[model samples]
Target chain A: MVDALSAVFQRPNFLAFVIIFLWGFYIMVTRYNLVKKLVGMYLVQTSVIFFLVSISAKKGATAPILLSTTDPVHAINYVNPLPHVLTLTAIVVGVATLGVGLALCSAIYRRYGSLDEEEILKRLE
Target chain B: MSRHFPAILFLLPLFAAISMPVVCLRHRHWSRPISLAVLSSMVVLSILNLNSIITHGEVRYAFSGWSAPLGIEWVADGLASMILVTLSFLGLLALVFAGPTSPKDLGGRIVHYYTLILLLISALTGIVFAGDLFNLFVFLEVAAIASYALIGVAGGRALFAAFRYLVLGTLGASLYLLGVSYFYAASGTLNMADMAEKLPHLLNSKAVVGGLLFMFIGLGIKMALVPFHAWLPDAYTYAPESISPILASLVTKVALVGWVRIIFWVLGAKVIVNDIPVLLLVGILGTLAAVIGAVLALNQRDIKAMFAYGGISHIGIILIGVSQGNQTGFVGGVFYLLNDAVMQAALFFLAGMAICQYGARTVEDVGRIGKQAPWFTGVLIIVAMGMIGLPPTGGFFGKWYIILGALEANNYIAVAAVLLSTLLTLAYFVRLFEAIFRQTPLPSDRLPSDIPFAYKLSLGATSAAVIMLGVFSDPIVQLLLNHALPPGL
Candidate 1:
């Protein structure tokens, strides 16, 4: 099994993909409540983030620090930091979306006086 | 430097979005022009960008002059450009609809609304343009955040609807991001074209299937594919009349396009067409949404809410075409999307006219006012016929192509669903028309006596577009299909 997993990682970008997408699936399908649902959703989005991050990964790569830190410009063995950077922006945007959604949820709870979907629908009817 | 204007077109909207609140901080009324100017320029820019891509085929620009996989890339392939241009036109039409039918306090929220609109547009444009998967996620977040807020802004039932959307939308967004992460790890390249180049090497792997499944589920929420569409009806029903067109017109289309790009391009034909159960999932789910949406819509009292359900049903029909993964099927889907957005926007706007002119909230109150408002009803009928997919309207063309594609694809059940829904869709809207137009006006609207000419002009413009796009679908389809269809299924 370890060999299978290691082999999956060796033949390209498989292991990283597995870990992220699975984690996302686990979160989204399992969560029930509204905020929890959002949490699950965020977990799934992590698969996308991981997918992006993994693309920039090299077999023996490290943090993508600048070349000048070593007092030599010839060597740059850093992992691709671009996906990480992209995810950062995505993360901020995601947080803003979460804030808006939460604000809306609070308002819904106030107006309809419930956070449960069944209860809300029942009251709405 | 000059080649970068299309990128700037999107950037301008985002920048303006950030500045809009500040600009409106003192003089709130000024936000409309800012909104108008942003939309007008976006439309113009989209047209130019679309023309370039169609005539030229695939215009890609690197951020800060960096190469793909190493640097962020912006792509103006035919597909994205088509979606962008159509989105722009729809945005303008929705704003026009909003300007007339919505509450007067609209201006109070103008700064925030327009800012969100511009930001949403900017993000959608980026999603289309981004050659990289991570960029797509980022753009999706930008658009999604704006939409979640826009849904809740109207208050009342809107908060409930927006809350539902937010929860579901967040789940979907995160899942999509997770899928992107997986794809990135496997491929070592975030660029879509690069992934296509690399994915074949990792074929028959569980990780690929895993990634595809995650993406489908995530995107499925946005596509509102039957079982996953729990958030759609409420979100659409409760959003302001002004925002409905944008929500109904652009939101789902963007998600659908993203789905196609990722599923077909990133995953490839073998995976989407034969492997990984996409066509089957799409077909089954699409058929269900089509049937269910129309059935539910048939029973609706609120015209907007009914149309919202009808819109989802149409999405099902569209997915059937798209899921075939054939060029013809895909092209038909795009055409269907183009027409549906326009026709739907027009009809919704007309509905808005009723709500604005009278104090009426539901369809039960739209009685005999057609005689009082002859022009409104006349435009309404044109838009209605468009929804019915009648002759000389874009809506008809939308149905015709999809039906044709379904038949060609030998998806008889899907084709049947499309045809059946047309009658059902017509039945509800026509009933709406009769309720309002058929009765003799014994009473006038309790609200305003006359709607402003500006609103009418915009409504008329959208109605005209419905007719024009139908008659000239060939050129429009040609523009959309030329670069929209990638090589192979």
Candidate 2:
């Protein structure tokens, strides 16, 4: 248990990912403002993206650029590139989601005259 | 050229969507025809793809000349191709039904409507064909984004509903991505087939288990399996008339299919059923959804909301079949998926038509509809019978197989849920039938306008397909579903 705790503490990125993710989820569930909820969702998505990018991280590894002088077989010299590529795509999807979410928020605000969840529901009733 | 059909299935719509605005610039009236043409061709191509898959087995197309595992691929197995055919077929019918209706409903935004619909169809096709996890996630997001806009286009309470869907949907997709990240970290590959091959060796790993759990939660939210179903009723209720059937029938169904693929095809049923208690959990949740959705649907006054809740109930039934974790169970689940798609689409279409023609927005308002529009009433009765799981309807066969599977699995709770939900379904639908056939007409009742020929044709086709599915369930199970079954099950 001590070793596992130390290992988890050593990987601060993963720890931070978890913290940020939970924080975002809490805000998403607890917040009444629609825009704040969107912000929470954005944070949640980006935290996941952070986790993905951190999965590719290595202690002393260089970027995955091919070098003529470097030994190609020594793949340990470079960080994994796949997760970086995935993170880029994920980032795009995140931006699109945020854009859509904010657009919906604006529309909701226009129609309901308020962005608070309670206010909107009451008005709807 | 034939091998490229899977790529074309999605690319055709995507390109059409991109060009829809430009095409409509010259002539405002051109958007509907262009959309119809694109969707019709999609249906044709999907049918051809299904035929080829049945004859030649699974087709894999790698992007940019790269082989599988190194680059992205699209796989069209029997199940994927069947889903493709179902999606495009329903999409075509929905688009056809939307043609005359959307202009009046959406006013000047018809162009954007077609664009978003085409984009949604493209994304759905991509989801069906995606051979890798990340590709599936991308397609899922594209579909979600388009649907968010589509739902919001109604621009009232719909906007708030769309916002709610967006929040939950993004969170779900993010969780799914987190799960994918875990899988990637453990397996070092994103290709689904490769990940499957690597997963068994890593089955003991905590990351693998955690990944599976996250994926289920994420997908469960997307598919709106009860408890996670908070967003569905409002989204379905408030969406514009033309868009409701498409969103109601295809979006959630595709997500469920994605979940099945991940659980059965990628993770393998042995792991889910034996190594873990995931199937049991699914069975429990499904039973809850079945009972709860039916009970909630029983109390709804708004016709659309009632059908929306009924949709949740049917999804629960499908999940019950899926959770049984056997070949018969899988067949039942898949069959019910198809049946529910047709049934929900028909119900929403009829509801939308009733609203448009007679301003009948509630069960009480639709009283004596049977006397005025006999054909409409007849279709409603057929759909209601199917929903009640009466024999000779598609819904009956799906439930029959599910019950048989549950009996085989000795899951008595699920069995009771299915039977109880069936009775509840009957009770609610009997009320609808009584309203349509027996109750006196409201004082404000007026003669409904004649429905367009195209609308009638789509309705006729869907109703016929529902019965045909039941009549031919045996052949479908034998010829298609047997092949569609994943290895071991």
Candidate 3:
């Protein structure tokens, strides 16, 4: 049982990535409302955050960090922490995207008095 | 001291962009000057770092002093530096042009406009210098989000265009993130160099190939290549005259750098380009886009929209050379990317100024305002010719090299499309010019009598630059060839 669980956990990132990509696709294509689409974008980007973080997670290892002489991964105790650091960059990006996306949504709402794609399209036409 | 500077290459713009708004609050008129000052200073800094980049080969600046596979790093070598300068300079010039275009038209919103543009510039700069898969995505998000806001300001139909862009843009970003996840899981590392090392061993993995497909599709959407380009025309057509030129010139070009970087550096060009399915897919999409973009461009009525389609066509042409996957061919493609943006922006910016001056949105709307706007008309004519790839223009060199590269490859289809697009380009631009420049004076000429010298100076500089870049294509191409795209790959 433990072995099966370890094997599954080893590839846990695949699960996180699939869920995120599919969620993003659903929101992008199916949603007609503008702000909802931005929400979907946030969901999608957060999924990427999950994937990047999962890349650093190990079955039995702590984060790839060295706190003291007692720490194990001093040689090989912890999991890879590189991706965790990289995800800091990703999180920053995600926040910026969300901020800009919401800002544009507000601007759109102000201009058209609606965020419906059909309503916007009617005006454009 | 110098070794550390390259690492902070991306961090500089990142800081400048984050601070532009803060600065604007203290002094509202300060955004453009500060953004330009920061960007120009960066150009000088990059130039100073060239030798370190070229001699030592790829330099990696790891954050927190940790090595790749353990920490985030910024990689700025020759290619990244060159791309940085190109993006920053164009960004600065666009900011300069935007500065003098009276903000009174937009009421009090100029602050919002300049501030967001500075942020966009920073994001574009960071993406060029990112050394890891995750950093690339992060910076791309910053750039894309800012660009979406830049596109639809003061709303109206601009909102429609921005919505279309947001839908497609989000899809592209997610696809890229998905690809990054696959690369991470497969290699267990997100650093570009580490991935390059692990890539050969995982060449046959279905997950890896799927990742490549997702990434290319995503970048393709951002670059507005062929099938993914439906959002671009509307976005460009509806964006304010002030923002149109920047979008026309820089947005797709930066995404192209990200596309090339991921494909070449992370995937390792030799493997990705040679892999049968990937090659075939790229070639097919590229060929179709090449033929279709030009043919479809002929039908556009809006001046900006037509140029947007034309820009898409040039993008397709650049790929024709790129898909060949040879040094000569790829170099032509990259150089063309630079030249294409410059010429396309020169033409588009002038048209934008005309639109602002005459309150005209479409070609037919401008009718005989040529007489009312003679000086603007003359500059527009030079730009229009350059757009058509006429001789003594930068546009011509991009076409010349692509054709030469195709001929070297003995690829007849590419050669045919190159020639065909030029003819189609000329056909459209000539008629548009005649309509705009034909001497039909209006009875009630109420257009602005004089556009500020700053506007004229910016346009004239770019127009002259089109011809100068063409005439000096030899040196520019050589410099780019020497610097951009690693020596062998």
Candidate 4:
């Protein structure tokens, strides 16, 4: 168990991803405020994005720039660019979701005058 | 031009959606005509595409001349084209229902509504045709975002419902993306066919197993398979009248299609069924969803909410069929998917009409509806019988096949669940019909108003299609579904 913990801690980014993801999930489930829930959602998304980006990283690697001098066969010299590209798309999706979430929050506040989930449910009733 | 049909199947609506706001700026009346024209053409193209697939084989098109495992690919196999036909046809009908009524109901926001409708349809098409996991994720998000706006367009309790849906939906999508990432880590490929080819060797890899688990949970939430169904009832109930039919019939079905693709096509049946017991888990949960949904549906006074709960039960039945992991089960699941789409759309349309004509809000409020609109009430009775899985309607055949599949798989528990849910469905519909035919309408109830020609056309066509599907189930399965079955199945 100690060895496993040390090994997991060695990969700090993965540890960070796990911790942040759990934190976000915890907030999302436990928070009463809708905005806080939205924030938690954002954090959860960010952690996933971080994990994706971290998976692309390699030691002693540079950016994925192919030139005439670079050997295509030894691809480990450069980080995998695909995950970066995917994370870019994921980030855009995350932002779009955040914008919609915030808009809904404001709309909910306008009608119910509160962003607390319980209060809003009471108003709806 | 014909060769480009796969690309144009989705791009047409997407381009039209992008140009809609600008086009509607001056000639607002043109929006309906343009939307109808585009959707009609889509229905034609989808039919033609299905024909071509039937004649030749699966059509594959890589964007900008880039092939698989390198760039994005779009595939229109037998199953994809069939779903495309269903979505585009239903989308056309929805736009028709929304045309005359929306301008009155939505006021100035009608243009935005049309745009989002087209966008949603386009994204759904993209999902059906997607050959890569990342592309599927993007399209899923596009469809989801469009639905969020569409649901919240009514702006009251609807906004809150949309918010709830948005939160849950985004979480689901993110989990899906995470799953894709894990798959990518394991296989180093995002193309589904390539991943499928590669995944067998890595079946025992922790990353692959984790990915499958995440993907199933994510899609389970998206498809609202009972435990994750908290977001569905309110969202479907509070959506604008015209939008509810489309949401009811298509959105969750499309999500289920995604789930089916990943599970059956990418992961393969042997792994899910024999190796890991994922299918067993799905089967058990599906049985749970079927019973729970029916019980919840029986208690709902609101008609749309009741139908929404019933939809969950139907989805559960479809999942139960698919999870049985046999040829008969696969075909039954696929057939139920198609049949339920038509039945649910018809139910919602009839409910909308009742709301429009008699101001009926609850099931009880629709009392004596048969006295007012005899023809529609007749259609409603047929549809209700279909929902109860009676013979001569499509729903009966779907349930019949699923029960047969369960028996074939020796899953007596699933067979019992199907039978029990059918009885529960009968109970609810019997109650609804009693309210419709037996009770007297309140004196303050408004006189029945004439439904629009569009409503009559769409509803009639859908109900007719339901009966036709039952009558023609054999040919459909033989011609399309058998060919669409995955190799192992």
Residue pairs with colliding backbones in model 3 are: A73-A77
Per-residue lDDT tens digits of candidate 3, residues B132-162?
Answer: 8877887787788887887777566776787
In terms of DockQ, the best-performing candidate is 2
* Candidate 1 interface RMS: 2.4
Residue-wise lDDT of candidate 4 within B1-489, one digit each (tens)? 666899999999999999999999888878888889999999999999988888888888999999989999998888898888988988898887786567655646878898999999999999999999999999999999999989998687889899989989988988888899899999999999999999988888889888877888788888898999999999999888888999999999999999888887887886743365777888899899999999999999999999999999999999999899887888888888999998889888887777765667798776656567775687888888788888898888888888888999999999999889999999988888888778776666557476789988888888898899899988887865646887687
Off by over 4 Å in 4: A69-73, B272-275, B442-446
**CAPRI-style quality class for the chain A–B interface of candidate 3:** medium
Residue B379 of model 1, lDDT score: 88
Residue-wise lDDT of candidate 1 within B1-489, one digit each (tens)?
A: 336756787888889889988888999878777788778888888888777766666777888888876778887777777777778888876766566555552435766788888888888888777777877777877788788888777677777778768767777777776667666666767788888889877866666677777778988887687788888877877677778778787788788877778777776654643354667777788888888889889998887778888888888878877776566777878788877777677766766666666645567776546667776778878887887789898778767777777778788888888888888888888788778766766643434556787677778888898899888988877766666776666
True contacts kept of each: 0.95, 0.93, 0.66, 0.78
Instruction: Give the better candidate number (1 or 2) by DockQ.
Output: 2
Q: How many residue pairs clash in each candidate?
A: 31, 0, 1, 0
Q: Model 1, stretches more than 4 Å misplaced? A: A1-62, A66-83, A109-125, B100-107, B270-277, B444-448
Per-candidate iRMS values, in order, are 2.4, 0.7, 2.0, 0.7
Sum up the clashes in candidate 2.
0
Give lDDT for model 4: 0.87
lDDT of 2 at B8: 91
lDDT of 4 by residue, A1-125 (tens): 99999999899998999999899988999999999999999999999899999988899988877755665557878899999999999999899989988988888888889999999898889
